[model samples]
Target: MGRSRPGPIRWLWYAVGGRLPDEYREWVLYDLTAPTWVLRHLCRAMVQHSVWLLLLLLPIPLTLRIWMVVTGVSVGLFFSLAFIEDASERRLIRQGFPVGLNRKIREESSGAQRSELAAMYAAYYTTEPDV
Candidate 1:
Protein backbone atom coordinates (compact mmCIF):
# COMPACT_ATOMS: atom_id res chain seq x y z
CA MET A 1 0.00 0.00 0.00
CA GLY A 2 1.08 3.58 -0.62
CA ARG A 3 2.17 5.68 2.31
CA SER A 4 0.17 8.63 3.55
CA ARG A 5 1.83 12.04 3.50
CA PRO A 6 1.31 15.10 5.60
CA GLY A 7 -0.42 18.24 4.41
CA PRO A 8 1.54 21.40 3.62
CA ILE A 9 1.01 22.84 7.08
CA ARG A 10 1.98 19.56 8.72
CA TRP A 11 4.96 19.33 6.40
CA LEU A 12 6.06 22.82 7.39
CA TRP A 13 5.85 21.82 11.00
CA TYR A 14 7.80 18.65 10.23
CA ALA A 15 10.48 20.61 8.38
CA VAL A 16 10.99 22.61 11.53
CA GLY A 17 11.57 19.48 13.68
CA GLY A 18 7.98 18.88 14.63
CA ARG A 19 6.72 15.34 14.90
CA LEU A 20 4.34 14.13 12.25
CA PRO A 21 1.07 12.32 12.84
CA ASP A 22 1.00 8.53 13.08
CA GLU A 23 -0.58 8.20 9.67
CA TYR A 24 2.51 9.77 8.10
CA ARG A 25 4.99 7.54 9.88
CA GLU A 26 5.62 5.19 6.98
CA TRP A 27 6.11 8.10 4.61
CA VAL A 28 8.62 9.56 7.01
CA LEU A 29 10.62 6.32 6.94
CA TYR A 30 10.52 6.18 3.18
CA ASP A 31 11.56 9.83 2.98
CA LEU A 32 14.62 9.25 5.12
CA THR A 33 15.56 5.98 3.42
CA ALA A 34 15.02 6.83 -0.23
CA PRO A 35 17.96 7.25 -2.59
CA THR A 36 17.36 10.99 -2.80
CA TRP A 37 17.21 11.30 0.97
CA VAL A 38 20.25 13.54 1.29
CA LEU A 39 18.91 15.98 -1.24
CA ARG A 40 15.56 15.91 0.51
CA HIS A 41 17.21 16.66 3.84
CA LEU A 42 19.14 19.56 2.31
CA CYS A 43 15.95 20.92 0.84
CA ARG A 44 14.30 20.79 4.26
CA ALA A 45 17.32 22.56 5.73
CA MET A 46 16.96 25.29 3.12
CA VAL A 47 13.33 25.72 4.11
CA GLN A 48 14.35 26.05 7.74
CA HIS A 49 17.05 28.60 6.92
CA SER A 50 14.65 30.57 4.76
CA VAL A 51 12.18 30.82 7.62
CA TRP A 52 14.93 32.20 9.86
CA LEU A 53 16.02 34.56 7.12
CA LEU A 54 12.70 36.37 7.52
CA LEU A 55 14.03 37.80 10.75
CA LEU A 56 16.67 39.78 8.92
CA LEU A 57 14.20 42.52 8.12
CA LEU A 58 15.90 45.33 9.97
CA PRO A 59 16.74 49.02 9.28
CA ILE A 60 19.97 47.92 7.62
CA PRO A 61 20.76 48.58 3.96
CA LEU A 62 19.32 46.18 1.42
CA THR A 63 22.72 44.96 0.23
CA LEU A 64 23.88 44.35 3.79
CA ARG A 65 20.74 42.41 4.65
CA ILE A 66 21.06 40.32 1.54
CA TRP A 67 24.69 39.61 2.31
CA MET A 68 23.84 38.58 5.86
CA VAL A 69 21.07 36.31 4.73
CA VAL A 70 23.29 34.70 2.13
CA THR A 71 26.09 34.18 4.61
CA GLY A 72 23.75 32.78 7.23
CA VAL A 73 22.19 30.34 4.81
CA SER A 74 25.55 29.20 3.53
CA VAL A 75 26.80 28.47 7.02
CA GLY A 76 23.56 26.81 7.99
CA LEU A 77 23.58 24.58 4.95
CA PHE A 78 27.20 23.65 5.54
CA PHE A 79 26.51 22.64 9.10
CA SER A 80 23.31 20.89 8.13
CA LEU A 81 25.12 18.80 5.55
CA ALA A 82 27.93 18.14 7.98
CA PHE A 83 25.56 16.80 10.60
CA ILE A 84 22.98 15.27 8.26
CA GLU A 85 23.17 11.75 9.69
CA ASP A 86 22.65 12.94 13.23
CA ALA A 87 19.81 15.23 12.22
CA SER A 88 18.03 12.60 10.20
CA GLU A 89 18.44 10.05 12.95
CA ARG A 90 17.00 12.47 15.45
CA ARG A 91 14.04 13.06 13.19
CA LEU A 92 13.46 9.35 12.87
CA ILE A 93 13.65 8.94 16.61
CA ARG A 94 11.13 11.72 17.10
CA GLN A 95 8.76 9.79 14.87
CA GLY A 96 9.09 6.68 17.11
CA PHE A 97 11.91 4.96 15.27
CA PRO A 98 14.83 3.42 17.10
CA VAL A 99 18.32 4.89 17.03
CA GLY A 100 20.49 3.84 14.04
CA LEU A 101 17.42 2.74 12.10
CA ASN A 102 18.12 5.35 9.45
CA ARG A 103 21.62 4.05 8.93
CA LYS A 104 20.39 0.49 8.85
CA ILE A 105 17.74 1.30 6.30
CA ARG A 106 20.14 3.26 4.11
CA GLU A 107 22.74 0.52 4.22
CA GLU A 108 20.21 -2.13 3.30
CA SER A 109 18.79 -0.06 0.47
CA SER A 110 22.26 0.58 -0.97
CA GLY A 111 23.54 -2.92 -0.51
CA ALA A 112 24.14 -3.63 -4.17
CA GLN A 113 26.05 -0.42 -4.79
CA ARG A 114 28.03 -0.92 -1.60
CA SER A 115 28.97 -4.47 -2.56
CA GLU A 116 30.04 -3.35 -6.02
CA LEU A 117 32.22 -0.62 -4.58
CA ALA A 118 33.73 -3.02 -2.09
CA ALA A 119 34.59 -5.45 -4.88
CA MET A 120 36.17 -2.65 -6.90
CA TYR A 121 38.18 -1.49 -3.90
CA ALA A 122 39.39 -5.02 -3.18
CA ALA A 123 40.45 -5.54 -6.81
CA TYR A 124 42.21 -2.18 -7.10
CA TYR A 125 43.69 -1.70 -3.66
CA THR A 126 44.29 -5.13 -2.08
CA THR A 127 47.76 -6.65 -2.52
CA GLU A 128 48.23 -10.38 -3.03
CA PRO A 129 51.43 -12.33 -2.33
CA ASP A 130 53.17 -13.90 -5.30
CA VAL A 131 52.18 -17.56 -5.76
Candidate 2:
Protein backbone atom coordinates (compact mmCIF):
# COMPACT_ATOMS: atom_id res chain seq x y z
CA MET A 1 0.00 0.00 0.00
CA GLY A 2 2.60 2.59 -1.09
CA ARG A 3 3.59 4.71 -4.03
CA SER A 4 6.59 4.35 -6.34
CA ARG A 5 7.83 7.93 -6.30
CA PRO A 6 7.66 11.08 -4.22
CA GLY A 7 5.55 13.80 -5.87
CA PRO A 8 6.65 17.31 -6.83
CA ILE A 9 5.21 18.94 -3.71
CA ARG A 10 6.81 16.31 -1.53
CA TRP A 11 10.12 17.22 -3.13
CA LEU A 12 9.32 20.86 -2.59
CA TRP A 13 8.36 20.13 0.99
CA TYR A 14 11.74 18.55 1.52
CA ALA A 15 13.45 21.21 -0.55
CA VAL A 16 12.35 23.92 1.79
CA GLY A 17 12.50 22.55 5.34
CA GLY A 18 10.81 19.32 6.39
CA ARG A 19 12.48 16.14 7.62
CA LEU A 20 9.78 13.52 7.73
CA PRO A 21 10.06 10.45 5.52
CA ASP A 22 8.02 10.22 2.31
CA GLU A 23 7.59 6.53 2.94
CA TYR A 24 7.54 4.41 6.09
CA ARG A 25 9.57 1.52 4.68
CA GLU A 26 12.41 4.00 4.26
CA TRP A 27 12.09 4.80 7.95
CA VAL A 28 12.22 1.19 9.12
CA LEU A 29 14.74 -0.09 6.62
CA TYR A 30 17.20 2.77 6.51
CA ASP A 31 16.60 4.70 9.74
CA LEU A 32 15.96 1.97 12.26
CA THR A 33 18.89 -0.01 13.64
CA ALA A 34 17.25 -3.41 13.68
CA PRO A 35 15.19 -2.84 10.49
CA THR A 36 13.30 -6.11 10.89
CA TRP A 37 10.06 -4.80 9.50
CA VAL A 38 8.98 -5.56 5.96
CA LEU A 39 5.71 -3.66 6.27
CA ARG A 40 5.24 -3.36 2.53
CA HIS A 41 6.64 -6.60 1.14
CA LEU A 42 6.64 -5.10 -2.35
CA CYS A 43 9.58 -2.82 -1.62
CA ARG A 44 12.24 -5.51 -2.01
CA ALA A 45 10.21 -7.15 -4.74
CA MET A 46 10.60 -4.11 -6.97
CA VAL A 47 14.33 -3.96 -6.29
CA GLN A 48 14.70 -7.60 -7.21
CA HIS A 49 12.83 -7.04 -10.44
CA SER A 50 14.94 -4.05 -11.31
CA VAL A 51 18.08 -6.17 -10.95
CA TRP A 52 16.51 -9.09 -12.73
CA LEU A 53 15.91 -6.92 -15.78
CA LEU A 54 19.66 -6.52 -16.04
CA LEU A 55 20.38 -10.22 -15.57
CA LEU A 56 17.79 -11.21 -18.18
CA LEU A 57 19.53 -9.12 -20.81
CA LEU A 58 22.43 -11.56 -21.03
CA PRO A 59 20.43 -14.58 -22.21
CA ILE A 60 18.46 -13.10 -25.13
CA PRO A 61 19.04 -14.19 -28.74
CA LEU A 62 21.76 -12.46 -30.77
CA THR A 63 19.21 -10.77 -33.04
CA LEU A 64 17.75 -9.10 -29.98
CA ARG A 65 20.95 -7.28 -29.09
CA ILE A 66 19.33 -3.93 -29.78
CA TRP A 67 16.38 -4.89 -27.62
CA MET A 68 18.76 -6.09 -24.95
CA VAL A 69 20.64 -2.82 -25.02
CA VAL A 70 17.42 -0.88 -24.77
CA THR A 71 16.23 -3.06 -21.95
CA GLY A 72 19.54 -2.68 -20.20
CA VAL A 73 19.40 1.07 -20.46
CA SER A 74 15.88 1.16 -19.10
CA VAL A 75 16.81 -1.05 -16.19
CA GLY A 76 19.92 1.02 -15.58
CA LEU A 77 17.81 4.16 -15.51
CA PHE A 78 15.48 2.58 -13.00
CA PHE A 79 18.44 1.68 -10.84
CA SER A 80 19.80 5.17 -11.24
CA LEU A 81 16.49 6.71 -10.18
CA ALA A 82 16.40 4.45 -7.16
CA PHE A 83 19.85 5.68 -6.21
CA ILE A 84 18.81 9.26 -6.90
CA GLU A 85 15.89 8.82 -4.55
CA ASP A 86 18.22 7.65 -1.80
CA ALA A 87 20.61 10.49 -2.46
CA SER A 88 17.75 12.97 -2.46
CA GLU A 89 16.52 11.53 0.80
CA ARG A 90 19.96 11.97 2.29
CA ARG A 91 20.10 15.51 1.00
CA LEU A 92 16.69 16.27 2.46
CA ILE A 93 17.88 14.93 5.80
CA ARG A 94 21.02 17.05 5.77
CA GLN A 95 18.85 20.01 4.88
CA GLY A 96 16.77 19.32 8.01
CA PHE A 97 13.58 17.80 6.63
CA PRO A 98 11.49 16.49 9.52
CA VAL A 99 12.21 12.82 10.21
CA GLY A 100 14.98 12.97 7.65
CA LEU A 101 17.34 10.77 9.58
CA ASN A 102 14.55 8.30 10.20
CA ARG A 103 13.80 8.14 6.48
CA LYS A 104 17.38 7.27 5.68
CA ILE A 105 17.50 4.60 8.33
CA ARG A 106 14.93 2.56 6.39
CA GLU A 107 17.84 0.63 4.83
CA GLU A 108 17.65 0.55 1.03
CA SER A 109 14.09 1.70 1.52
CA SER A 110 12.49 3.62 -1.31
CA GLY A 111 9.08 5.16 -1.94
CA ALA A 112 7.36 1.99 -0.89
CA GLN A 113 8.15 2.37 2.79
CA ARG A 114 5.86 5.26 3.55
CA SER A 115 2.39 4.35 4.68
CA GLU A 116 0.86 7.82 4.93
CA LEU A 117 3.11 10.53 3.60
CA ALA A 118 0.17 12.83 2.86
CA ALA A 119 -0.73 12.89 6.53
CA MET A 120 2.84 13.63 7.35
CA TYR A 121 2.69 16.56 4.98
CA ALA A 122 -0.50 17.78 6.63
CA ALA A 123 1.21 17.62 9.99
CA TYR A 124 4.18 19.42 8.57
CA TYR A 125 1.98 22.17 7.12
CA THR A 126 0.47 22.97 10.49
CA THR A 127 3.91 23.76 11.86
CA GLU A 128 4.59 26.11 8.95
CA PRO A 129 3.10 29.46 8.09
CA ASP A 130 1.30 30.08 4.82
CA VAL A 131 3.35 31.88 2.23
Candidate 3:
Protein backbone atom coordinates (compact mmCIF):
# COMPACT_ATOMS: atom_id res chain seq x y z
CA MET A 1 0.00 0.00 0.00
CA GLY A 2 1.34 3.43 -0.97
CA ARG A 3 0.08 6.96 -0.86
CA SER A 4 -2.77 7.62 -3.24
CA ARG A 5 -2.46 10.49 -5.61
CA PRO A 6 -4.93 13.32 -4.92
CA GLY A 7 -7.13 10.77 -3.11
CA PRO A 8 -8.23 7.14 -2.85
CA ILE A 9 -11.43 7.51 -4.84
CA ARG A 10 -9.29 7.11 -7.91
CA TRP A 11 -8.85 3.44 -7.05
CA LEU A 12 -12.57 2.86 -7.36
CA TRP A 13 -12.68 4.96 -10.51
CA TYR A 14 -9.97 2.94 -12.23
CA ALA A 15 -11.43 -0.39 -11.10
CA VAL A 16 -14.84 0.55 -12.44
CA GLY A 17 -13.31 1.67 -15.71
CA GLY A 18 -11.42 -1.62 -16.00
CA ARG A 19 -8.11 0.20 -15.90
CA LEU A 20 -5.68 -0.28 -13.04
CA PRO A 21 -4.14 2.85 -11.56
CA ASP A 22 -0.46 3.58 -12.16
CA GLU A 23 0.56 2.30 -8.74
CA TYR A 24 -1.26 -0.99 -9.22
CA ARG A 25 -0.80 -1.39 -12.97
CA GLU A 26 2.75 -2.62 -13.07
CA TRP A 27 2.34 -5.12 -10.25
CA VAL A 28 -0.90 -6.64 -11.45
CA LEU A 29 -0.23 -6.55 -15.18
CA TYR A 30 3.51 -7.12 -15.48
CA ASP A 31 4.96 -8.62 -12.33
CA LEU A 32 2.12 -11.00 -11.64
CA THR A 33 1.09 -11.21 -15.30
CA ALA A 34 -2.40 -11.90 -14.10
CA PRO A 35 -5.15 -12.79 -16.54
CA THR A 36 -7.86 -10.26 -15.88
CA TRP A 37 -10.58 -10.84 -18.45
CA VAL A 38 -12.87 -12.58 -16.01
CA LEU A 39 -12.50 -9.83 -13.43
CA ARG A 40 -12.92 -7.06 -15.98
CA HIS A 41 -15.95 -8.77 -17.47
CA LEU A 42 -17.49 -8.96 -14.03
CA CYS A 43 -16.91 -5.26 -13.52
CA ARG A 44 -18.17 -4.41 -17.01
CA ALA A 45 -21.26 -6.50 -16.44
CA MET A 46 -22.13 -4.53 -13.31
CA VAL A 47 -22.04 -1.23 -15.20
CA GLN A 48 -23.36 -2.48 -18.53
CA HIS A 49 -26.26 -4.39 -17.05
CA SER A 50 -27.37 -1.44 -14.98
CA VAL A 51 -27.31 0.76 -18.07
CA TRP A 52 -28.89 -1.75 -20.48
CA LEU A 53 -31.54 -2.72 -17.97
CA LEU A 54 -32.49 0.90 -17.54
CA LEU A 55 -32.90 1.21 -21.30
CA LEU A 56 -34.75 -2.09 -21.60
CA LEU A 57 -37.13 -1.26 -18.80
CA LEU A 58 -37.85 2.24 -19.99
CA PRO A 59 -41.60 2.89 -20.19
CA ILE A 60 -41.27 4.11 -23.76
CA PRO A 61 -41.12 1.14 -26.10
CA LEU A 62 -37.90 1.02 -28.09
CA THR A 63 -37.66 0.03 -31.73
CA LEU A 64 -35.63 -3.07 -32.67
CA ARG A 65 -32.91 -0.89 -34.28
CA ILE A 66 -32.40 1.11 -31.10
CA TRP A 67 -32.34 -2.00 -28.98
CA MET A 68 -29.76 -3.60 -31.27
CA VAL A 69 -27.55 -0.55 -31.16
CA VAL A 70 -27.51 -0.46 -27.38
CA THR A 71 -26.76 -4.16 -27.15
CA GLY A 72 -23.96 -3.88 -29.73
CA VAL A 73 -22.27 -0.98 -27.96
CA SER A 74 -22.51 -2.65 -24.57
CA VAL A 75 -20.94 -5.85 -25.90
CA GLY A 76 -18.16 -3.92 -27.63
CA LEU A 77 -17.26 -2.04 -24.49
CA PHE A 78 -17.25 -5.23 -22.45
CA PHE A 79 -14.99 -7.03 -24.89
CA SER A 80 -12.61 -4.10 -25.15
CA LEU A 81 -12.16 -3.76 -21.40
CA ALA A 82 -11.80 -7.51 -20.95
CA PHE A 83 -8.85 -7.72 -23.30
CA ILE A 84 -7.24 -4.35 -22.79
CA GLU A 85 -4.31 -5.62 -20.71
CA ASP A 86 -3.50 -8.44 -23.10
CA ALA A 87 -3.61 -6.04 -25.99
CA SER A 88 -1.42 -3.55 -24.15
CA GLU A 89 1.23 -6.15 -23.39
CA ARG A 90 1.24 -7.38 -26.97
CA ARG A 91 1.74 -3.86 -28.20
CA LEU A 92 4.57 -3.24 -25.75
CA ILE A 93 6.37 -6.41 -26.77
CA ARG A 94 5.98 -5.47 -30.40
CA GLN A 95 7.57 -2.14 -29.55
CA GLY A 96 10.60 -4.03 -28.18
CA PHE A 97 10.28 -3.18 -24.51
CA PRO A 98 12.51 -5.26 -22.28
CA VAL A 99 10.92 -8.07 -20.29
CA GLY A 100 12.05 -6.63 -16.97
CA LEU A 101 11.20 -3.04 -17.76
CA ASN A 102 8.17 -3.08 -15.51
CA ARG A 103 10.16 -4.29 -12.53
CA LYS A 104 12.76 -1.63 -13.06
CA ILE A 105 10.15 1.05 -13.42
CA ARG A 106 8.37 -0.11 -10.32
CA GLU A 107 11.54 0.07 -8.24
CA GLU A 108 12.42 3.56 -9.46
CA SER A 109 8.91 4.90 -9.01
CA SER A 110 8.54 3.31 -5.58
CA GLY A 111 11.73 4.89 -4.32
CA ALA A 112 10.77 8.29 -5.68
CA GLN A 113 7.32 8.02 -4.19
CA ARG A 114 8.71 7.12 -0.77
CA SER A 115 11.19 9.95 -0.81
CA GLU A 116 8.56 12.45 -1.84
CA LEU A 117 6.31 11.36 1.00
CA ALA A 118 9.16 11.50 3.46
CA ALA A 119 10.02 15.04 2.42
CA MET A 120 6.43 16.15 2.63
CA TYR A 121 5.97 14.70 6.11
CA ALA A 122 9.27 16.07 7.31
CA ALA A 123 8.28 19.53 6.22
CA TYR A 124 4.75 19.40 7.58
CA TYR A 125 5.51 17.76 10.95
CA THR A 126 8.82 19.30 11.75
CA THR A 127 8.66 20.87 15.26
CA GLU A 128 11.89 22.89 15.18
CA PRO A 129 11.48 26.31 13.60
CA ASP A 130 14.10 27.59 11.14
CA VAL A 131 16.49 30.13 12.64
The most accurate candidate by TM-score is 1
Q: What is the lDDT of residue 7 in candidate 2?
A: 62
lDDT of 3 by residue, 1-131 (tens): 34334244654454344444434433333322223434644553455445455455555657864685577667867675676555445433432343543333434545446444333432333344589
C-alpha local distance difference test of each model: 0.76, 0.44, 0.45
Q: Which stretch of 10 consecutive residues in model 3 shows the poorest summed lDDT? A: 25-34
- The RMSD of every model to the true structure, in order and in angstroms, is 12.0, 10.3, 11.3
Off by over 4 Å in 1: 111-131
**Candidate 1 structure quality by residue, lDDT tens digits, 55-129:** 478888988888889898999999999999999999988877667876865675574564343233323322445
Question: Where is model 1 poorest over a 10-residue stretch in terms of lDDT?
Answer: 117-126
lDDT of 2 by residue, 44-126 (tens): 33443444355455666755766675576667556745564454445444534555544433443445533344334334533
TM-score of each: 0.79, 0.27, 0.33
Q: How well does candidate 1 match the true structure, expressed as C-alpha RMSD?
A: 12.0
> How high a TM-score does candidate 1 get?
0.79
Better of 1 and 3 by TM-score: 1
Better of 2 and 3 by lDDT: 3
Error of 2 at 38 (Å): 11
In angstroms, the error of model 3 at 70 is: 8.7
